[model samples]
Target: MIGSMPILLPVLEPDAKEGDGKEDDSGDDGQRLANRCFVIGPDGGIIARYDKIHLFDVSLGAGESYRESRTYQGGAQAVLADIGPAKLGLSICYDLRFPYLYRALAQAGADILSIPAAFTETTGRAHWHVLLRARAIETGCFVMAPAQSGHHADGRDTFGHSLLVDPWGEVLVDAGRDRGVSLFTIDLDAVAAARARIPALGHDRPLTI
Candidate 1:
């Protein structure tokens, strides 16, 4: 999801469809727009927009504390978008730690997942890559994560290893703690192949205690 910002949006109609995202004149304005991601399709129109569901609210003692919920309301819905080659699921940084959400998206036919994160340097260094790879492996979906790197003007640091992980849990590209771009061709077939080989998504059983 794009970083935090207060956005003013127009009111939406009840008859609104999925292909185009519409907002209106009777503005609904606030910090809701900040923590969201949009999937633009081949035709250059907005196909889907997913608001970030999980907020980062943790007290990392020694004065290192973050309260994302203080700024914005978390999203109440999960969205999967049609992006021609694959059904892409949208989620933000903190949501990556929740596997059940990814499983729900996969069940809804998502073959590719996007995580746009502004992760803190401490936790990102420890859990970022591994968690992303695990999600890809479990869902058999290609995971594309674009992250915020280096330092922000507020004197905070981010662990900026923007990763592209394959369905087979391979690191295709890692944008390591630098302000730059990483581009690669995503082979959709790899998703199919990996899922066919492992089929882990199909093996899920009910949680029985």
Candidate 2:
């Protein structure tokens, strides 16, 4: 799965003025930032683009810490796009932790949710499959996750096992702990059937607690 494309944006100094003798390096020649995901149409055209709202910023102990916000700016909006057969909700790695985002996408008419990730071995083993299945069951939408597996050049080991979960929370396919391609067919009609049976998405009531 392709992650977000990093784009360069100009960084401006707020305090520096024109005659302050500070270097004039604004506009087009600044820093490379922006975690953006895109939906490319069959015609090789851009259909939709989404910036990843959630950034991975945590310390897993053992001196391992990630500060994604250091170089990349988090996205502010969630994007939904129509890809012919199904309306897709676009998201990147860390977005899986937030179920509300998936629920909102389903309510907004998204039938398929794409969450491409490179999860660490620790968290993936603990929560990956469970979370993916839960999301599908909760939203009655198909969950398609393509993950990065095995070791990388950066000296970090990733947890693989890419999964495709159906609307009923059934795992249609799992890619195991290695890097490989997996194929599976989904019935979009099942989305409606599952939601019809549970009807939980429409059962929300205001809470006073």
Candidate 3:
């Protein structure tokens, strides 16, 4: 597995009173609300740990609400860890929306990127595949997204289609709507070849907007 920092946070107690002055109907803590990391070596032994930088806490209608800020602390820095021949860039779900982060990772020599997410069904269905492909095409890096699938204990549904995309914006492998591990062997040479062909990373002209 890629060695990146996880943005960790603590779980918070629910608010005592609702707008109706009734007991709030929040569920028990079933998930570990912390940013945690596990470094798996070639032999499959953990080698490091890094916390996540961002948290997901929002109410997406239908009485669904989350407040991750109340539970976990935001991560302070980005993690760039070495994994075999690749410099892996680590990020979570919402982080994918920010292109600058991916650009920075590319500039920092990241050949592979990981974005593990529990995306909402609505957003994932609309933009998940397109966004993943775009990032891969833009950065010339392999993007591996192992996502949380199906409904959670809290009655929240997540879009679960774990994807592995290559530098040329090709879908290498897709684990569709399942709760199991998927393995893939990616050739690192593809990154260099793609970057060499396009050379977009070196063509940054100051433009007047």
Candidate 4:
């Protein structure tokens, strides 16, 4: 788990400029912000890149509305990258609510998952910890969540409490209600042990809708 300090004011792209009535320039401005994924291999080579899939677009108190989709383009696929002894799965903020995506990645052999988010204070307070722990328990995988905290240049506030959880629903490292990176030396044996105990993935039953 590596949580960096909140990005106060990320540079907005020229194409991501708001208030432009033309749809052709709808997502131009968001391209300016740096939303990239670097899959560092055991031999130290960047093997894959997975951009964010969802945008933060909501209305808070007092008629304040944010439309992130206006500036950013959604990612097309979920990425599973190999980094030394771990198969890491990548995701971002809003992707937490979607369990199917995570399940698909786990099925594809992801043992460690990464969810780097810039979550809002309201939602984070309500659901962040629970959702993260749940994802870990459900998939029987280790979860690393690096977050963006504090206020941003756009006047939006973010709740940052990055966490690193083991496969058995235990938080190994918690970066409390502040900033900075939180690191942990994960044990792959824990993943194997947890999966051996529960074996939920092998017993997944097809539900009929």
lDDT of candidate 1 over 74-175, digit per residue (tens): 677999887655688889889999999999999889988888888888888889999999999999999988888888899889898889999999999998
lDDT value for candidate 1?
0.77
Please identify model 3 stretches exceeding 4 Å from their true place: 1-33, 43-46, 205-209
* Model 3 per-residue lDDT tens digits across residues 7-111: 221123223221334332345442224465545565565544445566676777777777765554445567666775678887777778878788888888899
Candidate 2 lDDT trough over 10 residues, lowest sum: 7-16
Report the C-alpha displacement of residue 55, candidate 1, in angstroms.
0.6
TM-score result, candidate 3: 0.77
Model 1 residue 175 distance off true place after TM-score fit, in angstroms: 1.3
Candidate 2 residue-wise lDDT, 83-196, digit = tens: 776799888889999999999999999999988888998889999999999999999999988888988897778898999999999999999996677766678999999999
Q: How many steric overlaps are in each model, in order? A: 2, 0, 12, 6
Q: What is the C-alpha lDDT of each candidate?
A: 0.77, 0.80, 0.73, 0.74
Clashes of 2: 0
* Preferred candidate (lDDT higher): 1 or 3: 1
- Which structure is stronger by TM-score: 3 or 4? 4
